[model samples]
Target: MAGLPSTARVVIIGGGVVGTSSLYHLCKAGWTDCLLLEKNELTSGSTWHAAGNVPTFSSSWSLMNMQRYSTELYRGLAEAVDYPMNYHVTGSLRLAHTKERMQEFQRARGMGRYQGMDIDVVGLEEIKRRYPFIETHDLKGALYDPSDGDIDPAQLTQALAKG
Candidate 1:
């Protein structure tokens, strides 16, 4: 790698997922003279050990959209580049043990539905059927999203840096 440039139109201070993604988007938006400064190697920080769970369910519309876009970008980047992100779409299940939690799940489901997410409120029987490992005796219900999953943060960060 070459030394850092003396001048840049934009300078990013970190090389984690967020910083690298910001650089990538800026470059994509026609800011090729941008530079990223990292005291250590990229993804060596918290990004390297992240769970990398990408869930599209959120109460806020903007956050949901950003997550959806990020998921789509990761999927496309994995296919477009040689890097393997280890991305998975295994989905996520949020269990509710009380009536209040179930109500919260209901609100989340409504919000997800409004934002075009495929979320569902499942009963205890369905939860048991889907997740046989879960003990649903004290559970009221659960929220299930088919688009939620995990990825390898290290690989993802490297991929973004490469982009």
Candidate 2:
């Protein structure tokens, strides 16, 4: 084990997503004398088990915007740092199996559109066209967000650390 430094300009605890992200942003902002202390390997705790689902679907405008920003950040952060974040733009869907669900999706789609998101309440045909192998017989429609996707939390943490 290496000895801890006697002092640091900024000492961040843990090496999870938040900690690494804070470190990265701080360094980007010219705060380079920062230190991060981790009890174990980065993302060895809850971060490794996270689903890493990035979705822009939310009833709250602030949350939706934040998620959208996160998705965009993840899309470019890896390339900027020369690290692979393993971000996949697989998109997301809120399937509607019944008339009530379809109505709900339509309302949510409207909200998304109002908030300047490229969301759509797509029909069964569109869904089938996008995913030919999906078992859509029970689905009426869906609210789709093309920007939604998934990312590897562990890889992202490493990329942040590299920054």
Candidate 3:
């Protein structure tokens, strides 16, 4: 950034994970002459309120590609970089006791199967074995997306900015 001119080639509008991710990738791709302008502090707006869920298991090819890259980025933070992202890889469990929700889950599962994410159907017994903390009495079954997970928004933003 030192040798780069004052008039940067790219100007990013936000300071959240989305914007930070763009900036990180741009820098990695050698777009050194770029600037990200935040109207407020980093993670001050909607970024602060976001419950950081990995948006994987998408049906659309474009969404799937974005999520796949996002997953890889988060995994890199957990593995190569010393930047701990407060990420929990316990997985996502969508429970359904009623017929309506079950139908929706089935449709989504079929799509995820095509997308190649680690999403699958699980029964009550499997749910109990995987996550004993939940009370699964009335629940019929669940769609367990194994690669699905959560993250700490604050830490992730800071880490991406620094990285």
Candidate 3 lDDT score at position 44: 85
lDDT value, residue 100 of candidate 1: 94
lDDT of 2 by residue, 90-121 (tens): 88778889999888777767777877778899
How should the candidates be ordered by TM-score, best one leading?
Answer: 1, 2, 3
**Can you tell me which runs of candidate 1 are displaced by over 4 Å?**
1-3
Shift in Å, residue 15, candidate 1: 0.9
Candidate 3 residue-wise lDDT, 18-102, digit = tens: 8887898899899988898788888987889999988676546678667756776787775554677787776778888987777
lDDT of each: 0.86, 0.86, 0.79
Note each model's CA RMSD in angstroms. 2.0, 3.0, 3.5
Worst 10 residues of 1 by lDDT: 78-87
Q: How much is the lDDT of residue 27 in candidate 2?
A: 89
Which 10-residue window in model 3 sums to the lowest lDDT? 76-85
RMSD score of candidate 3 (Å):
3.5
Error of 2 at 70 (Å): 1.2
Kindly report which residue pairs in candidate 1 clash with one another. none
Q: If both were scored by lDDT, which would come out higher, candidate 2 or candidate 3? A: 2
* Positional deviation of residue 59's Cα in model 1 after best superposition, in angstroms: 3.4
